[model samples]
Each structure stands twice: as structure tokens, then as C-alpha cells.
Target: MGIKKQLGPIEIIVNNASVFDKLGLEEVSAQELDRHFAINVKAPFLLAKSMNEQLTTGSAGKIINLNDWRKARPTRLAYGVTKSALTGLTRTLALSLAPNIQVNEIAFGAYCHPQIYPWVDHVRISA
Candidate 1:
């Protein structure tokens, strides 16, 4: 039997995967923009749609989107634009999926990237 048969329908979805290309406007390419959006925006949308259907009735569900508040930052164009699109999607989903599913977004600040601080020890990266 499928998971639905064994357990039940999915109740929560957390969109956490994101592409953060450190390329600015002049250096950012079309493919980069597309790739960023494909992962950052499209994936969440598809997942949300699926979850919305699976949770159309019965108990309540929740969709939490992990967002970066640096969407307006000038250093990252594609990431910012896609994040903005996600914000719009989140608002629309919140409005449309109300009563049945709760769609929410949690904007986060910058943290240490492994590439940027390779020696900082991934566990204790507060430095």
C-alpha cells in the first residue's frame, strides 16, 4: 500500500531548497535566472499545488516557504526576482488555500556559506 494507505495524506510542506548564485546583473545569465527560478519558484509551486489537492478537505494542512529577505539586495538579481515571485505566490496561496491549508513564508537573514567560510567549522559557524 502507498503512504496514504499506511499513514495518511501529507500535512506539511517546507520549501527550503534555493539556488543562490553570487552573480550580479551584469554577470548573471539567462540560464542562471531560469535555473534559479526553476528550483526556487517552480518547485514550491508544484509542491504546493499537489499538497493543496491532497489536502482539499478534512483536517488542516500547512505550507511553509523558506525565503530570504535579501530579495531587494542589488548583488543578487535572479535570486531576488525569484524570491519576489515566491512572495507573490505565497500571498496568493495564502488567500486561495485558506480554511483548508495554511500557506506561510519565513524570511531569513544571510548565514555562512560553506564556500565562503570553509574553515569556520560547519557546526559552529557563528563567526
Candidate 2:
């Protein structure tokens, strides 16, 4: 018996929990990669599975996954890999949970202090 079952129905779920550790390809260990997948990918899948019944019963259920847009950054090797997998998960879930639950993803760009990333101005200008 989970909170969703106890409370009856759930209309929306936001999968925002993620682990962003800056580690290069060579620096990332197997355990770190597993951890990244567990938190960034598996957790959302489990949550959505658990809430499937309640979500289907709702008038309009929604599931939003917080993702990242930067894909080729070498510093975020494992993180990027997991996020890419999550993107696929979002697409798959959108198809599988259709008619009842709407699955979507919000991909974010680089988020750092303006002073730390002066190049952000170029992105802003280009956009």
C-alpha cells in the first residue's frame, strides 16, 4: 500500500530527481555508472509503474521527465549516457501510456553562474 493507493488517485508525476556528477569517461567507475542509471533512469520507471493504475483512472494524467540537452560533453560521460536512455524511456512510455497518461520530457541546457560560463552569452545570442 503506497501513498498513491492510500490517497486514491494521482493525476500528475514529475520525475525530477537526478544525479549530476562531473566525471570524464576514463574517470567514471562501473559502480558510478550503475548508480547513475539507477537514479536517473530506473527510479522514474518504477514510479510510473507503481502509479500506472491510479494514473489510468484519472481524467488526464501526466508524467514529465527532467532531462538534459547537452549530449557531447566529455566531462559528463555517464550522466549523458543515462539521460540519453531516459529520453528513450520518455518516448516509449508516451506510446505505451497513451490515451490516459501523457508522458513528456523537458530538456534543460547548461545551468551555471553567468560569470563561470561566459560562453553562455554565445548560446543566448545564437538562440
Candidate 3:
């Protein structure tokens, strides 16, 4: 694939990069939605597929994807939907690249608020 040829010997592939869209389904513009998918899902998929090409039989490699724990909430529907798809991609790729490559996803939830994060700290998770 293009990735393998472009960047050979990718020992570890970290699907850590992501983009968030705040708009609800009805308010989300086509361009914004496409950008979300491009960075969140498509990039990771291409990288994993490319890394699989470089991996040989009996060789070991890892692909880890960072996902959101708040994906079930309707407020984050667009972002959550894409992350859900990413989770599916992780599982499917794990099966396809099994016996040589290990693929996994991690879901995170917390209350750390960064300055750039637009989400208000009004919502609280009670467990």
C-alpha cells in the first residue's frame, strides 16, 4: 500500500490522533462531518492497513486506538458516532491482522477541562 512504501518499517502504529465536531446531527455541516471522519477514522484505518503490509509472518506489532467513554451520550452524537465506528474498525482489523499484529482500543472518561475544550463543565457523571 501507499503507506508502507511511503513510510517503511513502522514498528508501532498509535492511532492517537482525533478531531471533534460539536454540532448535532441536524446542525452538522457536510464539510465539518467529512473533516471529522477524515481525521478520526480514515487516517487510522489507512495507517493500520499500511502497517499490516510491512509486518511479516511471526513478527509482532501493535496498533492502539484511543476512544471516548462518553460516546453513548446524544450530546456528542457526531463525535460519538465516529468513535463507535473506529471501535468497530479496531475489532475488525484485529481479526484481519491476527497472529502477527495486535490491535486494540482504549476508551477514556474524566473531568479534566482544558482551555481549548469548548464543552462546558456543567454535565456531571454519577456512577
**Clashing residue pairs, backbone N/CA/C < 3 A, model 2:** none
Q: Looking at model 2, how many pairs of residues clash?
A: 0
Model 3 Cα shift for residue 99 (angstroms): 1.2
Q: In candidate 2, residue 52 scores what lDDT?
A: 78
CA RMSD of each candidate after superposition: 4.8, 3.5, 5.2
Order of all candidates by lDDT, from best down to worst?
Answer: 1, 2, 3
Top candidate (lDDT) = 1
Q: After superposition, how far is residue 98 of candidate 2 from its true place, in Å?
A: 0.4
Tell me the deviation in Å of residue 54 in model 2. Answer: 3.8
- Ten-residue stretch with the least lDDT total in model 3: 112-121
lDDT of 3 by residue, 1-127 (tens): 6865887678887888887756776777778778878988999999988888777766788999999877765655668778989999999999998868889998987664564255664655466
Comparison by lDDT, 2 against 3, better one: 2
Best by TM-score: 2
Whole-model lDDT per candidate: 0.87, 0.85, 0.81
Question: Can you tell me which runs of candidate 1 are displaced by over 4 Å?
Answer: 110-127
Better of 1 and 3 by TM-score: 1
